[model samples]
Target: MKKTLTGIFSGLAILIFILSIGLMISGTIALRRNEPVFVFGRAVAVVPTDSMVGNEPDSLDVNDMVIIRKATIDEVEIGDVIVFQGVNGSGNPILVIHRVVDIQDEGIITKGDNNSSIDQPSYQDYVSNDNFQGIFQTKITFLKPLSQMMSSSKSLIFGGLAIVLTIMLISEVIHLVRTYQDEKNEAIKKKHEEEIEALKEKQKQEIIEEILRDNQK
Candidate 1:
């Protein structure tokens, strides 16, 4: 039972470790391509700016990890926080997460919770149905620190590899322990068999002596 439990736990740990590495690798690739890594229609993002920080309970702070789910334009409504693709002042595309204040025939208007005014025209000019990404689901408090650590592609890769190495080391230790136990058990078994053989020989010699005495009588 103990061995079975150990095997089960080790298998689960390795499975989880592999899955974590896969996520980190895929996430790094997606970030490099300037895209979100979607998993089962959901994507996780790390907040880089404090634009959405406010007194509201749901306000997002910098380094917060959030989960977003895919949504359609028609499903969007006023006051809903959404992620969309926008452009910066230099015409470079960037992702923006803010609350939708209004929906117009052309597109939607979004504003940060803590910002003094609405987003500039340049930023939201390209915010259309095609640019819509997903709707905010909830913040993941536990992953906030990990998300912060994985801010860059290099760090993400390094952290992932480090974890993989750690898991491998643990697995090796378990394997060594099992090997030692098996060897110890085999030695004990051999010693018991040798002692039994010696006892059988002694018994046979005593029986022969008794038979010779009976024949002499």
Candidate 2:
């Protein structure tokens, strides 16, 4: 029984370690990419005060985990769900996730298929063809709980993150220590040069002192 318990615990620990490493690698890659740094780089922006709620055409719950991405028209096709900065009553600098009603060179126009009137503005001037977050991939409420894993937890979340970071930091410190030892070894070779310079300076001072003494004599 003791051995069995030990095996189960060991397995759990191994899984946890793998998960820890996975999170670290993900963070490093996303930091390089310059996209938002999320646990999975995914978000659950609550439908705050109903501003964007019911604005999405396909449908989204009051609090939904929107899977937003970065992309352009080539990536986005007709009928794909997307989120963009819309100048609607969506509460200033609004992020609206609606269907692509039409696409234009200047910008793209979208509307909540559920809403009676189309949004008030166009993204032509605002959205550069150069850069765009692709669009919302899907609307599923099931993954909502997973988003909570992206947040504060004393034991599970923060502790796991801390353990992973500590490993990286320790590796860096070991590298620096090794480098310092190498530099120290090189300095040992310079000891003879330092001694030689000191001796030369001493001889010059002695010669000057001797000349002064001879003149006095």
Candidate 3:
């Protein structure tokens, strides 16, 4: 029982740590990138492709963590990974993570690392700095496993963990309640026993007093 309780609490603590680190990473990036979607603009973006792998570009990996940095259109230089909003009809505000292949006076041209060629030929015209979210600067490790988890059967992963945690928490509560009730019942029983002993002592003293009165008579 002790071990189970300890394990449950320990798991919960670790999970909380994972969550806090993720939040801090994301929040810090969102703050630096000026993203209203996250508090403090410290948002993390995904490494969309492996172009940066052999390129020795920051040792980044596919699905690795990337910190977002809000910069002016002028600062969007070559080789930097930029995340931006795509055109209309895109679902859920598309976030395109691509390296800056070319920067022009009016727009930028981006390309995927693993792909055979650059993005749509119309890429240059679609580039909008006003819609830019942030540029990738650093890596965030805590989000990698979380990213994998969410990618693989997100509902099942989250639901299963939630169920397990809830069960453990509920069991702990029940165990504590039982312990408290047992202590209360034991205390009441002991109090009753003490009261009985006290009554017997009183009776003995009364009998002695009655005997003394009879002798005087």
Candidate 4:
């Protein structure tokens, strides 16, 4: 029973490790492409700015991980926080997360919770099905901080992951070696017991022959 449970747990751990690696690889690729990572149509994003942060403790802050899902333009309403791609000062695509304050035929107006004024009208001034990714559904805190650290030093993170996988592999190898040794020991013990039993039977026969010879005399 103990061995069975151990095997079950080990299998589960390996499965989890594989899944984690897959997620990390996919997430890295998506980030490099500046795209949202969708798992079953739900997108995951790390909050890069504190624009949505407020004085409340429950408010979304920098490094908070947000899960986004696709929504139509007609489904969007005022006061809903949305993530969209916007051009930065350098004309590069950047993700912006803010709440919609007003809805217009052209586009939606957005502002940060902590900001003083609304964002200026520009190419990103309106929300459309093409540029709009989705609305934020959940906020996971503290993971963003860890993600930032990992992003800053990718080599270290990758090295650590490599080390962990190596350790797991080594552990499995050790378990196999130990199991083989145990089986080998059991076989040796069983052979020794058989030889001892054979010796005892031969002695019993010799005693019976000696008694028969005395009776014949």
Collision count of model 2: 7
| Candidate 2 off by > 4 Å | 1-58, 87-91, 120-127, 143-217
lDDT (0 to 1) per candidate: 0.76, 0.54, 0.61, 0.70
**TM-score for every candidate vs. truth?**
0.58, 0.41, 0.46, 0.55
Cα lDDT tens digits for candidate 3, 1-217: 9998899778767765665556546544543553423323344445544655645455567767566666666777888777776532333444677777877665777776665566545542346667666777677666677555544673543343343334434455557768987999999999999999999999999999999999999
Worst-scoring 10-residue span by lDDT in model 3: 34-43
Could you say which candidate leads in TM-score? 1
lDDT head-to-head 2 vs 3, winner: 3
Positional deviation of residue 40's Cα in model 1 after best superposition, in angstroms: 0.8
Best by lDDT: 1
lDDT score for residue 17 of model 1 = 73
Model 1, 16-134: lDDT tens per residue? 57756676687667666666666556776777788899877668998787778888888998888999887666878777889888887878888989888887464566357788888
Better of 1 and 4 by lDDT: 1
Clashing pairs in 1: none
RMSD of each: 13.3, 15.7, 15.7, 13.8
- Among residues 3 or more apart in sequence or in different chains, the pairs in candidate 4 whose N, CA or C atoms overlap within 3 Å are 107-126
